[model samples]
Target: MKISIITVCYNSDATLEKTILSVGGQTYKNIEHIIVDGLSSDNTVKIIQKHQDKIAHWISEPDKGLYDAMNKGIEMATGDIVGILNSDDTFFSKAVLSEIALFHTKNTIDASVGNIIQHKADGKVVRAYSSKYWKPEKLKIGFMPPHPSIFFRRTLFNTLGFYELGFIIGADYELITRFFLKANISWKYSGITTTAMLVGGLSSSGSSSYQLITTEIQKALTMNGLYFSPFKIKMRFAWKIIGFLKK
Candidate 1:
Protein backbone atom coordinates (compact mmCIF):
# COMPACT_ATOMS: atom_id res chain seq x y z
CA MET A 1 0.00 0.00 0.00
CA LYS A 2 1.22 3.48 -0.80
CA ILE A 3 1.64 5.81 2.20
CA SER A 4 1.59 9.59 2.04
CA ILE A 5 3.65 11.21 4.80
CA ILE A 6 3.04 14.91 5.47
CA THR A 7 5.50 17.23 7.20
CA VAL A 8 4.27 20.65 8.31
CA CYS A 9 6.72 23.43 9.07
CA TYR A 10 7.18 27.11 9.75
CA ASN A 11 10.58 28.70 10.48
CA SER A 12 12.12 25.30 11.07
CA ASP A 13 15.29 25.36 8.96
CA ALA A 14 17.30 24.19 11.92
CA THR A 15 15.40 20.92 12.20
CA LEU A 16 13.66 20.40 8.83
CA GLU A 17 16.60 18.60 7.23
CA LYS A 18 16.51 15.85 9.84
CA THR A 19 12.82 15.19 9.09
CA ILE A 20 13.44 15.31 5.34
CA LEU A 21 16.30 12.82 5.51
CA SER A 22 14.29 10.56 7.76
CA VAL A 23 11.39 10.41 5.26
CA GLY A 24 13.76 10.08 2.30
CA GLY A 25 15.51 7.16 3.97
CA GLN A 26 12.36 5.12 4.42
CA THR A 27 12.64 1.48 3.30
CA TYR A 28 9.20 1.62 1.68
CA LYS A 29 9.56 2.89 -1.88
CA ASN A 30 5.90 3.53 -2.69
CA ILE A 31 5.78 6.50 -0.35
CA GLU A 32 5.00 10.12 -1.12
CA HIS A 33 6.41 13.01 0.91
CA ILE A 34 4.30 16.17 1.09
CA ILE A 35 5.42 19.33 2.84
CA VAL A 36 3.33 22.40 3.73
CA ASP A 37 5.43 25.31 4.84
CA GLY A 38 4.04 28.49 6.42
CA LEU A 39 6.18 30.85 4.32
CA SER A 40 9.07 30.88 6.72
CA SER A 41 11.45 33.87 6.84
CA ASP A 42 14.41 31.67 7.66
CA ASN A 43 16.30 29.30 5.33
CA THR A 44 13.44 26.82 5.53
CA VAL A 45 12.30 27.44 1.95
CA LYS A 46 15.87 27.17 0.71
CA ILE A 47 16.29 23.90 2.57
CA ILE A 48 13.05 22.59 1.08
CA GLN A 49 14.17 23.60 -2.43
CA LYS A 50 17.45 21.80 -1.87
CA HIS A 51 15.57 18.54 -1.43
CA GLN A 52 12.74 19.41 -3.84
CA ASP A 53 13.54 16.60 -6.23
CA LYS A 54 13.14 13.96 -3.52
CA ILE A 55 9.89 15.39 -2.17
CA ALA A 56 6.74 14.51 -4.11
CA HIS A 57 4.84 17.76 -3.59
CA TRP A 58 5.62 20.84 -1.46
CA ILE A 59 4.33 24.37 -1.03
CA SER A 60 5.96 27.26 0.84
CA GLU A 61 3.14 29.71 1.46
CA PRO A 62 1.67 31.51 4.42
CA ASP A 63 -1.04 29.49 6.17
CA LYS A 64 -3.50 30.08 9.00
CA GLY A 65 -1.49 27.94 11.42
CA LEU A 66 -0.32 24.40 12.13
CA TYR A 67 -3.70 22.72 11.68
CA ASP A 68 -4.37 24.68 8.50
CA ALA A 69 -1.08 23.49 7.03
CA MET A 70 -1.94 19.93 8.02
CA ASN A 71 -5.36 20.25 6.41
CA LYS A 72 -3.69 21.38 3.20
CA GLY A 73 -1.35 18.42 3.31
CA ILE A 74 -4.31 16.08 3.79
CA GLU A 75 -5.99 17.56 0.75
CA MET A 76 -2.84 17.03 -1.32
CA ALA A 77 -2.31 13.47 -0.17
CA THR A 78 -2.93 10.75 -2.81
CA GLY A 79 -1.77 7.64 -1.02
CA ASP A 80 -3.84 4.75 0.34
CA ILE A 81 -2.70 5.53 3.86
CA VAL A 82 -1.85 8.88 5.48
CA GLY A 83 0.40 9.94 8.34
CA ILE A 84 1.86 13.17 9.68
CA LEU A 85 5.39 13.80 10.91
CA ASN A 86 6.17 17.16 12.42
CA SER A 87 9.19 19.16 11.30
CA ASP A 88 10.94 18.56 14.62
CA ASP A 89 10.29 14.82 14.62
CA THR A 90 11.75 11.85 12.74
CA PHE A 91 10.98 8.22 12.12
CA PHE A 92 12.44 5.91 14.72
CA SER A 93 14.26 4.01 11.95
CA LYS A 94 14.44 3.53 8.18
CA ALA A 95 12.24 0.42 8.35
CA VAL A 96 9.38 2.19 10.11
CA LEU A 97 7.25 2.66 7.01
CA SER A 98 7.97 -0.84 5.80
CA GLU A 99 6.83 -2.24 9.12
CA ILE A 100 3.65 -0.20 8.96
CA ALA A 101 2.88 -1.51 5.49
CA LEU A 102 3.44 -5.08 6.57
CA PHE A 103 1.19 -4.70 9.59
CA HIS A 104 -1.66 -3.22 7.57
CA THR A 105 -1.38 -6.01 5.01
CA LYS A 106 -1.67 -8.64 7.73
CA ASN A 107 -4.53 -7.16 9.68
CA THR A 108 -7.68 -5.22 8.87
CA ILE A 109 -7.15 -2.05 10.83
CA ASP A 110 -8.44 1.46 10.24
CA ALA A 111 -5.51 2.92 12.21
CA SER A 112 -2.27 1.70 13.75
CA VAL A 113 -0.16 3.44 16.37
CA GLY A 114 3.02 2.79 18.34
CA ASN A 115 5.38 4.32 20.91
CA ILE A 116 7.20 7.66 20.77
CA ILE A 117 10.35 8.94 22.45
CA GLN A 118 10.59 12.58 23.50
CA HIS A 119 14.01 14.14 22.85
CA LYS A 120 15.60 17.37 23.94
CA ALA A 121 16.69 20.23 21.67
CA ASP A 122 20.27 19.01 22.06
CA GLY A 123 19.29 15.56 20.71
CA LYS A 124 19.10 13.92 24.10
CA VAL A 125 16.41 11.27 24.66
CA VAL A 126 14.20 12.39 27.52
CA ARG A 127 11.52 9.76 28.00
CA ALA A 128 9.42 7.22 26.13
CA TYR A 129 5.62 7.59 26.12
CA SER A 130 4.11 4.24 25.28
CA SER A 131 0.48 4.00 24.18
CA LYS A 132 -1.83 1.92 26.27
CA TYR A 133 -3.29 -1.11 24.58
CA TRP A 134 -6.57 0.25 23.13
CA LYS A 135 -9.41 0.24 25.63
CA PRO A 136 -12.52 2.39 26.11
CA GLU A 137 -11.98 2.81 29.84
CA LYS A 138 -8.41 4.04 29.41
CA LEU A 139 -9.56 6.62 26.86
CA LYS A 140 -12.00 8.06 29.41
CA ILE A 141 -9.02 9.02 31.60
CA GLY A 142 -7.41 11.10 28.79
CA PHE A 143 -5.32 8.34 27.23
CA MET A 144 -4.57 8.88 23.53
CA PRO A 145 -2.20 7.63 20.87
CA PRO A 146 0.45 10.13 19.88
CA HIS A 147 -0.41 11.73 16.52
CA PRO A 148 3.08 11.23 15.07
CA SER A 149 3.00 7.52 15.80
CA ILE A 150 -0.38 7.02 14.09
CA PHE A 151 -0.89 5.77 10.52
CA PHE A 152 -4.45 5.51 9.34
CA ARG A 153 -6.25 4.65 6.14
CA ARG A 154 -7.09 7.85 4.33
CA THR A 155 -10.70 6.76 4.13
CA LEU A 156 -11.04 7.53 7.80
CA PHE A 157 -11.02 11.18 6.91
CA ASN A 158 -13.63 10.71 4.18
CA THR A 159 -15.81 9.03 6.78
CA LEU A 160 -15.17 11.20 9.82
CA GLY A 161 -13.66 14.39 8.40
CA PHE A 162 -10.23 15.93 9.04
CA TYR A 163 -8.94 17.63 12.18
CA GLU A 164 -11.19 20.46 13.32
CA LEU A 165 -9.60 23.79 12.52
CA GLY A 166 -11.36 25.32 15.55
CA PHE A 167 -8.84 23.81 17.94
CA ILE A 168 -5.42 25.42 18.13
CA ILE A 169 -3.66 23.29 20.73
CA GLY A 170 -5.94 20.29 21.14
CA ALA A 171 -7.21 19.46 17.63
CA ASP A 172 -5.13 16.30 17.38
CA TYR A 173 -6.38 15.08 20.70
CA GLU A 174 -9.94 15.82 19.61
CA LEU A 175 -9.49 13.99 16.33
CA ILE A 176 -8.10 10.90 18.04
CA THR A 177 -10.96 10.85 20.51
CA ARG A 178 -13.52 11.15 17.74
CA PHE A 179 -12.00 8.29 15.78
CA PHE A 180 -11.03 5.82 18.50
CA LEU A 181 -13.53 6.40 21.26
CA LYS A 182 -16.65 7.72 19.58
CA ALA A 183 -16.54 5.93 16.25
CA ASN A 184 -15.23 2.60 17.58
CA ILE A 185 -13.02 2.00 14.59
CA SER A 186 -10.79 -1.02 14.19
CA TRP A 187 -7.41 0.19 15.42
CA LYS A 188 -4.32 -1.75 16.40
CA TYR A 189 -1.40 -1.07 18.67
CA SER A 190 1.88 -1.95 16.95
CA GLY A 191 3.61 -2.26 20.31
CA ILE A 192 6.80 -0.94 18.67
CA THR A 193 8.62 2.37 18.55
CA THR A 194 7.54 4.74 15.79
CA THR A 195 8.64 8.39 16.10
CA ALA A 196 11.16 10.44 18.08
CA MET A 197 9.65 13.80 19.01
CA LEU A 198 11.34 16.89 20.41
CA VAL A 199 10.47 17.49 24.05
CA GLY A 200 9.47 21.16 23.76
CA GLY A 201 6.56 20.62 21.37
CA LEU A 202 3.36 22.63 21.79
CA SER A 203 1.38 19.96 23.63
CA SER A 204 4.29 18.33 25.40
CA SER A 205 5.79 21.07 27.58
CA GLY A 206 5.79 24.69 28.73
CA SER A 207 3.08 26.71 30.49
CA SER A 208 0.51 26.22 27.73
CA SER A 209 0.77 22.45 28.08
CA TYR A 210 -1.51 22.47 31.12
CA GLN A 211 -4.23 24.34 29.30
CA LEU A 212 -3.95 22.04 26.34
CA ILE A 213 -4.27 18.95 28.49
CA THR A 214 -7.31 20.23 30.35
CA THR A 215 -9.01 21.29 27.15
CA GLU A 216 -8.25 17.96 25.53
CA ILE A 217 -9.56 15.89 28.44
CA GLN A 218 -12.70 17.99 28.67
CA LYS A 219 -13.31 17.72 24.95
CA ALA A 220 -12.64 14.00 24.91
CA LEU A 221 -15.11 13.35 27.71
CA THR A 222 -17.77 15.60 26.27
CA MET A 223 -17.50 14.26 22.72
CA ASN A 224 -17.66 10.67 23.90
CA GLY A 225 -20.87 11.36 25.87
CA LEU A 226 -19.08 10.78 29.15
CA TYR A 227 -20.11 13.23 31.86
CA PHE A 228 -17.29 14.52 34.05
CA SER A 229 -18.30 15.64 37.54
CA PRO A 230 -16.45 18.54 39.21
CA PHE A 231 -14.52 15.98 41.22
CA LYS A 232 -13.60 14.06 38.08
CA ILE A 233 -12.32 17.21 36.44
CA LYS A 234 -10.19 17.96 39.48
CA MET A 235 -8.90 14.41 39.44
CA ARG A 236 -7.86 14.85 35.82
CA PHE A 237 -6.12 18.12 36.69
CA ALA A 238 -4.28 16.33 39.48
CA TRP A 239 -3.14 13.69 36.99
CA LYS A 240 -1.74 16.40 34.74
CA ILE A 241 0.17 17.89 37.66
CA ILE A 242 1.63 14.48 38.47
CA GLY A 243 2.65 14.06 34.85
CA PHE A 244 4.37 17.44 34.81
CA LEU A 245 6.23 16.54 38.00
CA LYS A 246 7.43 13.29 36.41
CA LYS A 247 8.62 15.22 33.37
Candidate 2:
Protein backbone atom coordinates (compact mmCIF):
# COMPACT_ATOMS: atom_id res chain seq x y z
CA MET A 1 0.00 0.00 0.00
CA LYS A 2 1.17 3.48 -0.77
CA ILE A 3 1.63 5.86 2.16
CA SER A 4 1.64 9.64 2.00
CA ILE A 5 3.66 11.44 4.66
CA ILE A 6 2.64 15.07 5.22
CA THR A 7 5.09 17.44 6.90
CA VAL A 8 3.90 20.91 7.86
CA CYS A 9 6.42 23.56 8.89
CA TYR A 10 7.18 27.24 9.48
CA ASN A 11 10.76 28.48 9.78
CA SER A 12 12.01 24.92 10.22
CA ASP A 13 15.34 25.27 8.44
CA ALA A 14 17.51 23.77 11.15
CA THR A 15 15.59 20.48 11.43
CA LEU A 16 13.69 20.17 8.15
CA GLU A 17 16.56 18.42 6.36
CA LYS A 18 16.64 15.62 8.95
CA THR A 19 12.91 15.15 8.56
CA ILE A 20 13.26 15.01 4.77
CA LEU A 21 16.15 12.56 4.89
CA SER A 22 14.24 10.31 7.28
CA VAL A 23 11.43 9.88 4.76
CA GLY A 24 13.89 9.37 1.90
CA GLY A 25 15.62 6.66 3.89
CA GLN A 26 12.47 4.74 4.72
CA THR A 27 12.51 1.11 3.63
CA TYR A 28 9.03 1.54 2.27
CA LYS A 29 9.40 2.85 -1.27
CA ASN A 30 5.79 3.49 -2.23
CA ILE A 31 5.72 6.70 -0.24
CA GLU A 32 5.14 10.33 -1.14
CA HIS A 33 6.51 13.16 1.00
CA ILE A 34 4.35 16.30 0.83
CA ILE A 35 5.39 19.52 2.52
CA VAL A 36 3.22 22.51 3.47
CA ASP A 37 5.25 25.48 4.58
CA GLY A 38 3.68 28.54 6.20
CA LEU A 39 5.71 31.18 4.33
CA SER A 40 8.75 30.85 6.53
CA SER A 41 11.18 33.78 6.60
CA ASP A 42 14.12 31.51 7.33
CA ASN A 43 16.06 29.17 5.04
CA THR A 44 13.31 26.55 5.26
CA VAL A 45 12.27 27.16 1.67
CA LYS A 46 15.87 27.04 0.51
CA ILE A 47 16.30 23.72 2.26
CA ILE A 48 13.20 22.43 0.54
CA GLN A 49 14.66 23.48 -2.81
CA LYS A 50 17.99 21.83 -1.97
CA HIS A 51 16.21 18.52 -1.47
CA GLN A 52 13.42 18.98 -4.00
CA ASP A 53 14.29 15.63 -5.58
CA LYS A 54 13.42 13.89 -2.31
CA ILE A 55 10.10 15.70 -1.92
CA ALA A 56 7.10 14.63 -3.97
CA HIS A 57 5.02 17.77 -3.54
CA TRP A 58 5.60 21.01 -1.56
CA ILE A 59 4.20 24.52 -1.16
CA SER A 60 5.35 27.60 0.75
CA GLU A 61 2.52 30.01 1.48
CA PRO A 62 0.69 31.72 4.29
CA ASP A 63 -1.62 29.40 6.19
CA LYS A 64 -3.98 29.77 9.11
CA GLY A 65 -1.81 27.68 11.40
CA LEU A 66 -0.38 24.19 11.97
CA TYR A 67 -3.71 22.41 11.49
CA ASP A 68 -4.46 24.42 8.38
CA ALA A 69 -1.17 23.41 6.78
CA MET A 70 -1.95 19.80 7.69
CA ASN A 71 -5.33 20.09 6.00
CA LYS A 72 -3.62 21.32 2.83
CA GLY A 73 -1.24 18.37 2.84
CA ILE A 74 -4.09 15.91 3.46
CA GLU A 75 -6.02 17.36 0.54
CA MET A 76 -2.92 16.92 -1.61
CA ALA A 77 -2.28 13.36 -0.47
CA THR A 78 -2.86 10.56 -3.00
CA GLY A 79 -1.78 7.54 -1.00
CA ASP A 80 -4.09 4.98 0.59
CA ILE A 81 -2.68 5.70 4.06
CA VAL A 82 -1.77 9.17 5.28
CA GLY A 83 0.33 10.35 8.22
CA ILE A 84 1.61 13.59 9.67
CA LEU A 85 5.30 14.06 10.44
CA ASN A 86 6.17 17.37 11.99
CA SER A 87 9.23 19.24 10.71
CA ASP A 88 11.10 18.65 13.97
CA ASP A 89 10.44 14.89 14.05
CA THR A 90 12.01 11.93 12.28
CA PHE A 91 11.19 8.28 11.77
CA PHE A 92 12.54 6.11 14.54
CA SER A 93 14.17 3.86 11.96
CA LYS A 94 14.37 3.31 8.22
CA ALA A 95 11.93 0.43 8.67
CA VAL A 96 9.26 2.40 10.52
CA LEU A 97 6.95 2.78 7.52
CA SER A 98 7.83 -0.70 6.36
CA GLU A 99 6.60 -2.09 9.68
CA ILE A 100 3.43 -0.03 9.47
CA ALA A 101 2.70 -1.37 5.99
CA LEU A 102 3.26 -4.95 7.05
CA PHE A 103 1.03 -4.66 10.10
CA HIS A 104 -1.77 -2.86 8.30
CA THR A 105 -1.69 -5.33 5.43
CA LYS A 106 -2.16 -8.16 7.90
CA ASN A 107 -5.00 -6.54 9.82
CA THR A 108 -8.28 -5.00 8.81
CA ILE A 109 -8.17 -1.68 10.58
CA ASP A 110 -8.81 1.98 9.83
CA ALA A 111 -5.68 3.26 11.54
CA SER A 112 -2.39 1.76 12.66
CA VAL A 113 -0.93 3.30 15.77
CA GLY A 114 2.53 2.96 17.29
CA ASN A 115 4.83 4.33 19.97
CA ILE A 116 7.13 7.35 19.99
CA ILE A 117 10.10 8.71 21.89
CA GLN A 118 9.91 12.35 22.95
CA HIS A 119 13.43 13.70 23.05
CA LYS A 120 15.47 16.88 23.17
CA ALA A 121 16.91 18.61 20.11
CA ASP A 122 20.26 17.15 21.23
CA GLY A 123 18.70 13.65 21.19
CA LYS A 124 18.39 13.04 24.95
CA VAL A 125 15.31 11.04 25.80
CA VAL A 126 12.52 12.70 27.74
CA ARG A 127 9.89 9.95 27.68
CA ALA A 128 8.43 7.21 25.50
CA TYR A 129 4.70 7.12 24.76
CA SER A 130 2.97 3.87 23.95
CA SER A 131 -0.44 3.33 22.38
CA LYS A 132 -0.98 0.14 24.34
CA TYR A 133 -2.99 1.87 27.06
CA TRP A 134 -5.10 4.09 24.83
CA LYS A 135 -8.80 3.41 24.39
CA PRO A 136 -11.68 5.46 23.09
CA GLU A 137 -13.16 5.70 26.59
CA LYS A 138 -10.00 7.39 27.83
CA LEU A 139 -10.83 10.53 25.85
CA LYS A 140 -12.83 11.76 28.84
CA ILE A 141 -9.66 11.71 30.91
CA GLY A 142 -7.53 13.17 28.11
CA PHE A 143 -5.60 10.09 27.06
CA MET A 144 -4.42 9.89 23.47
CA PRO A 145 -1.91 8.00 21.43
CA PRO A 146 1.13 9.83 20.18
CA HIS A 147 -0.11 11.80 17.16
CA PRO A 148 3.06 11.31 15.12
CA SER A 149 2.91 7.55 15.57
CA ILE A 150 -0.50 7.09 14.00
CA PHE A 151 -0.86 6.15 10.31
CA PHE A 152 -4.44 6.59 9.21
CA ARG A 153 -6.23 5.40 6.14
CA ARG A 154 -6.79 8.46 3.98
CA THR A 155 -10.51 7.69 3.71
CA LEU A 156 -11.00 8.57 7.42
CA PHE A 157 -10.59 12.24 6.57
CA ASN A 158 -13.26 12.03 3.87
CA THR A 159 -15.72 9.84 5.80
CA LEU A 160 -15.34 11.17 9.33
CA GLY A 161 -13.90 14.72 9.02
CA PHE A 162 -10.78 16.83 8.93
CA TYR A 163 -9.04 18.46 11.88
CA GLU A 164 -11.22 21.11 13.49
CA LEU A 165 -9.62 24.40 12.48
CA GLY A 166 -11.31 26.12 15.40
CA PHE A 167 -8.76 24.71 17.81
CA ILE A 168 -5.32 26.22 18.44
CA ILE A 169 -3.60 23.47 20.44
CA GLY A 170 -6.13 20.63 20.58
CA ALA A 171 -7.12 19.95 16.97
CA ASP A 172 -5.31 16.65 17.04
CA TYR A 173 -7.08 15.65 20.24
CA GLU A 174 -10.40 16.73 18.80
CA LEU A 175 -9.83 14.84 15.59
CA ILE A 176 -8.91 11.68 17.43
CA THR A 177 -11.95 12.01 19.70
CA ARG A 178 -14.19 12.56 16.70
CA PHE A 179 -12.86 9.49 14.96
CA PHE A 180 -12.29 6.97 17.71
CA LEU A 181 -15.08 7.97 20.08
CA LYS A 182 -17.87 9.48 18.02
CA ALA A 183 -17.26 7.69 14.75
CA ASN A 184 -15.91 4.49 16.35
CA ILE A 185 -13.18 3.87 13.79
CA SER A 186 -11.28 0.59 14.02
CA TRP A 187 -7.63 0.78 15.05
CA LYS A 188 -4.76 -1.36 16.23
CA TYR A 189 -1.49 -0.77 18.04
CA SER A 190 1.48 -2.06 16.06
CA GLY A 191 3.87 -1.73 19.04
CA ILE A 192 6.43 -0.23 16.69
CA THR A 193 8.45 2.83 17.56
CA THR A 194 7.37 5.07 14.72
CA THR A 195 8.77 8.56 15.31
CA ALA A 196 11.36 10.35 17.38
CA MET A 197 9.41 13.47 18.29
CA LEU A 198 11.19 16.64 19.34
CA VAL A 199 10.12 18.23 22.59
CA GLY A 200 8.63 21.78 22.61
CA GLY A 201 6.23 21.33 19.71
CA LEU A 202 2.80 22.92 19.82
CA SER A 203 1.64 20.55 22.57
CA SER A 204 4.79 19.64 24.47
CA SER A 205 6.60 22.71 25.73
CA GLY A 206 6.00 23.75 29.36
CA SER A 207 3.46 24.43 32.10
CA SER A 208 1.77 27.08 29.97
CA SER A 209 1.57 24.67 27.07
CA TYR A 210 0.03 22.07 29.38
CA GLN A 211 -2.62 24.53 30.50
CA LEU A 212 -3.44 25.46 26.91
CA ILE A 213 -3.75 21.82 25.88
CA THR A 214 -5.83 20.94 28.94
CA THR A 215 -8.27 23.69 28.13
CA GLU A 216 -8.37 22.61 24.52
CA ILE A 217 -8.86 18.98 25.47
CA GLN A 218 -11.86 19.87 27.57
CA LYS A 219 -13.21 21.95 24.73
CA ALA A 220 -12.66 19.05 22.38
CA LEU A 221 -14.52 16.65 24.67
CA THR A 222 -17.41 19.05 25.01
CA MET A 223 -17.60 19.57 21.26
CA ASN A 224 -17.77 15.82 20.79
CA GLY A 225 -20.50 15.44 23.43
CA LEU A 226 -18.24 13.39 25.66
CA TYR A 227 -18.24 13.57 29.44
CA PHE A 228 -15.23 15.40 30.89
CA SER A 229 -14.28 17.09 34.13
CA PRO A 230 -11.60 19.64 34.85
CA PHE A 231 -10.51 17.35 37.67
CA LYS A 232 -10.17 14.35 35.34
CA ILE A 233 -8.24 16.50 32.90
CA LYS A 234 -5.81 17.31 35.69
CA MET A 235 -5.50 13.61 36.39
CA ARG A 236 -3.92 13.10 33.01
CA PHE A 237 -0.83 14.69 34.48
CA ALA A 238 -0.47 11.74 36.79
CA TRP A 239 -0.54 9.44 33.78
CA LYS A 240 2.10 11.62 32.13
CA ILE A 241 4.24 11.33 35.22
CA ILE A 242 3.88 7.56 35.08
CA GLY A 243 4.97 7.68 31.45
CA PHE A 244 8.07 9.61 32.43
CA LEU A 245 8.78 7.18 35.27
CA LYS A 246 8.61 4.32 32.80
CA LYS A 247 11.59 5.84 31.02
Q: Highest lDDT, which number?
A: 2
Tens digits of per-residue lDDT, candidate 2, 179-204, equal: 99999999998999999998887777
Stretches of candidate 2 above 4 Å error?
239-247
Writing each residue's lDDT as its tens digit, candidate 1 over 1-247 gives 9999999999999999999999999888999999999999999999999998779999989888999899899899999889999998999999999999999899899998888898888879988877755454555666667778889899889889888777767788778878887888898888768899987788767657766677667875786586656345537657757877996
Clashes in candidate 1: how many?
0
lDDT of candidate 2 vs native?
0.92
Error of 1 at 199 (Å): 0.9
Error of 1 at 134 (Å): 4.4
Which stretches of candidate 1 lie above 4 Å from their native place? Answer: 237-247
Q: lDDT (0-100) at residue 216 of candidate 2?
A: 93
Q: lDDT of model 1 at residue 154?
A: 90
Overall lDDT per candidate, in order of appearance: 0.84, 0.92
Q: Provide backbone clash counts, one per model.
A: 0, 0
